[model samples]
Target chain A: MKVTVRYFAQLRDAAGTGSEQVEGDFRTPADLWTHLCARHVFPLGAADLRVSVNARYVPFEAPLGEGDEVAFIPPVSGG
Target chain B: MFVLQASPLPGGADLLPPGDLACGGVVVFEGRVRDHNEGRAVTALEYEAYEALAQAEGERILAEAAQRFGPVRVAAAHRQGLLQLGEAAVVVVAASAHRQEAFAACRWVIDAIKERLPVWKREHYVDGTRAWVACGCHHHGPEAP
Candidate 1:
């Protein structure tokens, strides 16, 4: 399946871009992030991040479908 | 009014909802970009968010806040992009039939934003250095040793 991976904050800085597309057999959000951490050398652990699939916060083990929009949420610092 | 603004949050302190006989109290809170942080002379801040998720989460929080706080109407706005010192980075307002619920809702929304929202803050210091204001758990920068 083809997955679009998005980076934010430090993850974006490390990867040099905010988003990209990947083609792999990754079935879960954790799998996709682990692949990116290896490919881009992300500084944080894949398990340490929060993820949302299709604009909704979900568990790391949430299943990913083809052409899913996944977001990696960093520790929030808003008001 | 859970919105992700790309520009400055002007008049944030005055953004409130219309009051009626039903509401006896209104609470407003603004999160400003302070001039200093962590013993550093901070000049500016950069706020970034997963806009889609941020919006969805923010709206959800507003819905939940209303349900939790009896007879309260709440709204929130968070800024994105670069913000100078003293700018209103975020604003939240709650109006309720009584002071207690309004106050509680105001506090709850802001606290939840800090914890649950997907936004991240990057501190730009005056000494030509910048760092992502980490939450003590995540945010290992580009070169984490």
Candidate 2:
């Protein structure tokens, strides 16, 4: 399966790119994220991060599939 | 207009969309960029967002506010990219049958937007330093195992 992973805020800065495409058979978003952290050391971790699948906020355990858009959301500061 | 916009958000007496005859009041809130924070002299702020997620979640929040505070129409817009100090970073407006509902709905929209929206603010200080603010889904530094 393939998924498009997007990063926002500081994570984007840490990763040096906002989005990327990856091929994996991860059962959950957490798995995909772990793969990313291995490739690019994101400054934040699971406890301070929120995962979203298909643009809706989801738990790290959320299922993943081909063509899914998975985003790692950092703490938002907008008021 | 639950939106993630690039320009300044609009306000004033015309804050709410017209047509509701029962609109007895409209409440508005604008969050501005401050000149300083934590003893750092701030110059400006740059906001970034996951547009797709932010838009979807922003709309959901407005819809929820309207549903929870019955008879109210809620709209909110958050800015992206660089924002000068004192500029409006976000604006929320609510119109309802009365002032109470209007105020309550407005408050609900802002709170939900802050916690749920996928927007991030970066503070540029006068000393040539910049840092991302800790907000939204998480706070604190790295945690223990």
Candidate 3:
């Protein structure tokens, strides 16, 4: 299933774009991350990042749906 | 109230809502961009956020603070984009009937924001190098083999 992926901070710098559409039969966020890592040299690993689907935080193992909006969140540093 | 904006944040006093007759104590916390970090002389900092989720999560944090320390009113705002040294990057204000709750709520809100907000800071050093500020609680650098 295809999904829209969003990147922020370091991931954004690595991805070279804020968001993009990826076409693949990705089963979960982890699967999608693996696919993305192959394309972009992200600074952090999947275990160090959090996954959000449709703007809500979810486990990396959570299932992905077609047209889902996914974001790989890096370590937050807001004050 | 929780807000993420590209414009400069309101002054600490301006961030507080109108006075509440029942509330006798008020506390405000402003996080400013410092000139140095990690032994490096920082020139400036840029903050980026997942606006949609950051707004939602930030509002949730304020709501949680209100519930946890009831009889208090809390509000917070975080600035986006570039910020110069000594500029207020974020602000939090809390008012309550007594000093303890107001102080506690204000502190709680800021701490929670640091941990949960979908915001990132990039520090630009005097030597022209830059790096994302990694939260000490997370393993953010190069991945382990």
Candidate 4:
């Protein structure tokens, strides 16, 4: 299955794009991240990054569905 | 209609002229641009937002505020882009039949706005430095001087 991944803030700058597609048999959010780390030389460290699927924040082990728009929400401090 | 604006504007103080209705109680909350953060002298602040989501989020909060506070007129707005010190970052106004509901609604709207909204703020320091607040990231890039 193909899953879409998104990065935000400094993560996006590091990854060089806001979104991308990855091909994997991953059934969970953690699986997807493992695939990305194994395949690409991610500019931003993927470990310790927050994960979200379909715009809602989620845990790393969150189940993955095909075509889900997962996003890595970089920590932001705003007031 | 609940209003949410991204452009810079005066705080809720400017909302008083919109209506002088017989509302027994009017409550407003204005968030100002402060001058200090994390022991640094903040010279100015800039805000960036996903506009559509921000508006939708604001309206959602307003609707809930009205529902929770009794029948009332509520308006909430947030300033976007570069903002100088003392400028208004956000304004929330609530007018109701009683002061209690009005105050409660105003407070709810502002707190909801801060907690859930997808807005990011960048703080600019007097020494030509800037940092993203709440950005829980290790500083691996060039440090601001």
DockQ-superior candidate, 1 or 2: 1
RMSD values, in order shown: 4.7, 4.4, 4.4, 6.4
- Model 3, A1-79: lDDT tens per residue? 8999999999999999999999886899999999998899988998789988998889989999999999999998876
lDDT of 2 by residue, B19-137 (tens): 78888798888888888877789999999888899899998998888789988888888889999989888888998888999988887777777778888889999888899986622
Strongest candidate by DockQ: 1
True contacts kept of each: 0.82, 0.82, 0.80, 0.25
Candidate structures ordered by lDDT, highest first: 3, 2, 1, 4
Query: TM-score of every model?
Result: 0.92, 0.92, 0.92, 0.69
Candidate 3: how close is chain B to the reference, as a TM-score?
0.91
What is the iRMSD of the candidate numbered 1?
5.9
Q: Scoring model 2 with DockQ, what do you get?
A: 0.58
Residue B44 lDDT, candidate 3, scale 0-100: 93
Residue A15 lDDT in model 1? 89
* Candidate 1 chain B least-lDDT 10 residues: B136-145
For model 1, residues B14-93, the per-residue Cα lDDT tens digits are 46647556988888888888888768898988888898899999999999998998688888889999988888888888
lDDT of 3 at B33: 92
Model 1: per-residue Cα lDDT over A5-33, one tens digit each: 78899889988999999999799998888
Considering just chain B, what TM-score does every model have? 0.88, 0.89, 0.91, 0.83
Candidate 4 Cα errors over 4 Å, as ranges: A1-6, A19-70, A74-79, B1-6, B10-22, B135-145
- Model 1 residue runs over 4 Å out of place are B10-14, B136-145
